[model samples]
Target: MNLNIMGPLAVNELISMDTNLLLAFFIGVGSGFVLESCGFSSSRKLVGVFYGYDTVVLKVFFTGAITAMLGLLFFSLFGWIDLNLVYVNELFLWSTLIGGVVMGAGFITGGFCPGTSFCGAAIGKKDAMVFIIGLFIGVAIFMAGILCGRDYTRPHS
Candidate 1:
């Protein structure tokens, strides 16, 4: 059987710890190699988020959105998953737009989006590592705030 990562990566486990682990590992390595080879891994390429020198990020993001929209439409048509059953977070218009702008600004300033930050860390980019560290800290803080509902949590652990 051709074990695919789509399902397993989503659910947690892969085919087996033996071949599946190696397969997934090498697959990730190979994808990173290709991204770097294609200049997608470079900070320069990411500056498209800023001065218009690059548009790959926008293109990729839009394309992925288009793909997902289409997939959701089709999947709903086929009744694979229920669309109405999915819940959207209560709309915070300001936070949504502000977050998008800040995220895009961060992309321009850091040349590393959230998704690419991990790739940068994987390939030994110091800035990427720092960015990821900051990201984790932010996430931890947010989660602790949500779970504990007070400053007493500290989120040290």
Candidate 2:
């Protein structure tokens, strides 16, 4: 008889908006602290991955992915989480390829992925500040295009 369908917690009425926001704020701060401590705020560290020098980023990400996967599996097996309720985005081949190329180029040239850029900017890195500005501009342009009713999925002929 529960009417709320926004999310698992929302549907169950286990968390209020204020509590959720507080949790998110703490989580974000904790994530930022972890990023800073791990040397993720350095462009040199990130670029080193591409130059075949440092593999810490890859190793950390791989470990995180495996941990998350196993945690999800365990939760599902224990019936603590319903895997069927998870939302999955629809796959688009062309969009995926194009976005990957764009992101890869940005990573190599600017030495900052979106999350790392945020972390770096938080610590007052000039290059990261520029990257953050560019990121916002790109997002604004994309939003404008969406607002203009342009279908991004269709391949331009």
TM-score of each: 0.60, 0.85
- Which is the leading candidate under lDDT? 2
lDDT of 1 by residue, 98-143 (tens): 6678777777677776667777777788888888887888679768
RMSD in order of candidates:
7.0, 4.2
- Clashes per model (N, Cα, C within 3 A): 1, 0
Give the Cα lDDT of each candidate.
0.68, 0.83
RMSD of 1: 7.0
Least accurate stretch of 10 residues (summed lDDT) in model 2?
Answer: 2-11
Window of ten residues with lowest summed lDDT in model 1: 2-11
TM-score between candidate 2 and the true structure: 0.85
Off by over 4 Å in 2: 1-8, 153-157
Residue pairs that clash (backbone atoms under 3 angstroms), model 2: none
